[model samples]
Target: MKTFLFRSMIGIFFGAFLAVAITNCAVYFGGQELLDGETFLKNSLGSIFCGWFFTVSPLYFELKNLRLSQQTALHFMTVTILYFSLSFWIGWIPLHLKSILFFSGMFLTTYAIIWLSFYFYFKNIAKKLNQDLENI
Candidate 1:
């Protein structure tokens, strides 16, 4: 419980930082005021929630009965739902089928890349550890 609280605190701050950074970048690059005050607040809060959820969601994997694939799938589904719902609510994405689909594709692609990178990274670490054990 203490560890979870600590992680949640970290996640909230990280999420806030990310939200501000992303917003600033969008304002700078897009060359337009992207959000009014109310919307900006909503976006910021939504981002914090997302950060918290993402950080904590890995706890689901601690369930010994679920396979890795199952854990990943469940996490992915929850994240997708949370992200898109927030996106739409925060007015980041237009409430149109085409826009939703396009964003969904982009999000899925990015998620897959990150997930694969982590998977391979841990796999390499495991392999190296096993090799060292064999040498021992």
Candidate 2:
């Protein structure tokens, strides 16, 4: 529980940071004024909520009962849908076919990247642990 809270705090910090960074980059590059303070606050809070929800949702599931492939597929689909809906609702993404497709592609790419990175990291840790056990 303490670990979960710690991770949630980190996730919210990064999520808010990413949200601001991306918005700042887009507005700066486009030569547009920043969003009004209230709007920016809303967006930032939305991002924080999204991050919290994402972490909590996965914890509610019993992924250990599923195979690795199943877990990956479930995580991919759930996260993609959850993010799409949240983004669209919060006006980060537009509600149109092209926007949906583009967002989906981007989400899928990032999801795969993060998932594969963790997959390899944990696999390496397990391998090292096995070697140590053998030495013992």
Global lDDT of each candidate = 0.88, 0.78
Candidate 2, poorest ten consecutive residues by summed lDDT = 54-63
Writing each residue's lDDT as its tens digit, candidate 2 over 1-136 gives 8867876987788778877887788699977775777777778888887777677556533557788877767766777677777788889899889988987788778877977898899899999999999999
Model 1: per-residue Cα lDDT over 1-136, one tens digit each: 8868987998899999999998999899988665788877898999999898888777766778999999899989888888888888888899999998899899989999988998899999999999999999
Best by TM-score: 1
| Residue 115 shift from truth in candidate 2, angstroms | 1.1
Error of 2 at 87 (Å): 0.7
lDDT of 1 at 101: 89
Q: Which regions in candidate 1 have their CA more than 4 angstroms from the true location?
A: 26-35
Model 1 worst lDDT window (10 residues): 32-41
Task: Itemize residue pairs with steric clashes in candidate 2.
Answer: none
